[model samples]
Target: MQEISYKQKVLKEAKRQGIISCWFFLANFAASFLIAVYKAFTQPHTLKQLQNLELIDSVITNLTTLAATIYIWLAIKKLADIYDTDVYEIFIKAVIAVVLAIFLLLALGLEGITPGAVKAVSYVLVGIGIYFFILWFKLNFALAKITNNKLFKTYVFFAIISAVVGGAIKTLAMFGFFEGGVYMLAAALSIAILYVLPTAFYLYAWTMIKEE
Candidate 1:
């Protein structure tokens, strides 16, 4: 039997780990959804009205955000296992990527270009640009440590894939794909599902592409 290369082994492990992490996220999302629904019923207002309750809304949002962050951290840790790299190092890199992205966005405002262009571009640049940077940083750093491939190239590949998935979701929401009282509930559910789906896909693709 031909011996599999270390890179291949790492890729295979990453894929398996990624898929497992996705399942964890799915479970968390389900739990969060149930909590959201229970809260909706217990509260004295409609869902839209509940959204205006800053304290309650903040609590719910923070829980969801924490779930997402933990999911990413776990995925990175799994990738680090395959790559033989320090998980802390990967995490630190992820943090740096986020900080740099924020600085860049701040710089954009400082440059004082037209207010109109800034208003339009700021959202896209800050929103999508920061997200891609984080994805690229994690994907490339983990992949390079495992595969001896160029980090930038792997980052580019991951960034493109992540961007397309994110853009599609945003486009759907912007077009009023879910509108109405009942539809608002449906929209909230859809948003939660959409959020989970990309993470699921990324995990699956990473497993498939990385040499096992």
Candidate 2:
């Protein structure tokens, strides 16, 4: 039997491991969501109104972290196919990326140096930058393993597009683009859509690249 080409092997492993990684993320999201609901329901009546904000924010952050972890695993799986690297190595790298991203955001948020006028803006920028960096690193590394091209470029392209879309939607919502008490829900849904859309696009791009 003809042996599988290196590219085919990497792609196949990536696909299989990607499925596992996605399932893991789904499980994490579900658990986080349940926890958020529990927290919301059991909280004080006065805090119940605030519960949605806190709980939903927590859920979104946790889901984002879970997704990052899975991407890191996918990257490591790809590397293993190419270099026979141990899974532990991938886990370490992924952890490092996630930790660094979180650290950056926390540091920026707590710095207390920026002026009040720009503090919120700075924090937002730091958070977005950290997230985009981790995502770009993970996706580019995985794509590089599959095809030795400029993976980072494509990753950044899709990432910026996603951010723009997400930001625009949030801005409009904040400016009363949506009426009624459902604005918060609209914002949350926009965030969810933003998070998934880019990943979906990247997956499609990767598939097309692999088929070539």
Candidate 3:
């Protein structure tokens, strides 16, 4: 077999990441849109109907998330060679943890869930978020190590800014510091960050891709 150089490897990885990013955005977008339509149409006039609808939504969301995790994992296992990192294992573990956490989060959204369960599960979610932090760190570290590209760093901060500012606004609104419209805006902003901001940065990074 012909020995491939570093530039070839980087290019291959870049192309792979580009494909992965598109699928990530599309799959999540479809899931989000379907969820919106489901919530809009599934308004129940009776207790049993409400329970059934909620169950269906949970299954839909969980399956979509599971698919996303697996699809992203395919891209992830490719990256262990791009930057020579050991995060493939970490990535697998994080995905497992996050899938569980997401289920817990969805349960918390259920109508009659207890406050005690919510409180306890909220802390567990935060702990699970730490796994995400580790995953993010590994990705950025690998990117920085492989190329001189600083776009990942920018993506990182803007992503964080979106979450922090949005969360603060949402929290204040919840505390009665704002009205309905403001609260809605805050919620939208947070969701937008979680879903849209990364894709924006990801596409930009691809435009600026270089061998390094």
Top lDDT prediction, candidate number: 3
* Candidate 2 deviant stretches above 4 angstroms: 1-11, 22-71, 74-77, 80-97, 104-145, 148-156, 181-189, 203-212
Writing each residue's lDDT as its tens digit, candidate 3 over 1-212 gives 23357646755675466556555565665566565556555554488866766676667666656665564566556556655566567767766787798699899989988889889999999988887887876676555555566876777777777778767766776788866556555655656666566666765765565643
Q: List the residue pairs that clash in candidate 2.
A: none
Q: Write the per-residue lDDT of candidate 2 for residues 111-189, one digit (tens) a residue.
A: 5556763666566667766665675566566455545545435755776777787888888997889865476566656
* lDDT of each residue in 2-108, candidate 1, tens digit only: 44566456456655655565565566656566656766567677768666565564666656556656655665665565555665475666666666666657866
What TM-score quantifies how close candidate 2 is to the native fold? 0.54
C-alpha lDDT of residue 18 in model 3: 55
lDDT score, candidate 2, position 142: 49
Q: What is candidate 2's local distance difference test score?
A: 0.59
For all predicted structures, in order, the TM-scores are 0.45, 0.54, 0.65
Better of 2 and 3 by lDDT: 3
Backbone clash count, each prediction separately: 5, 0, 0
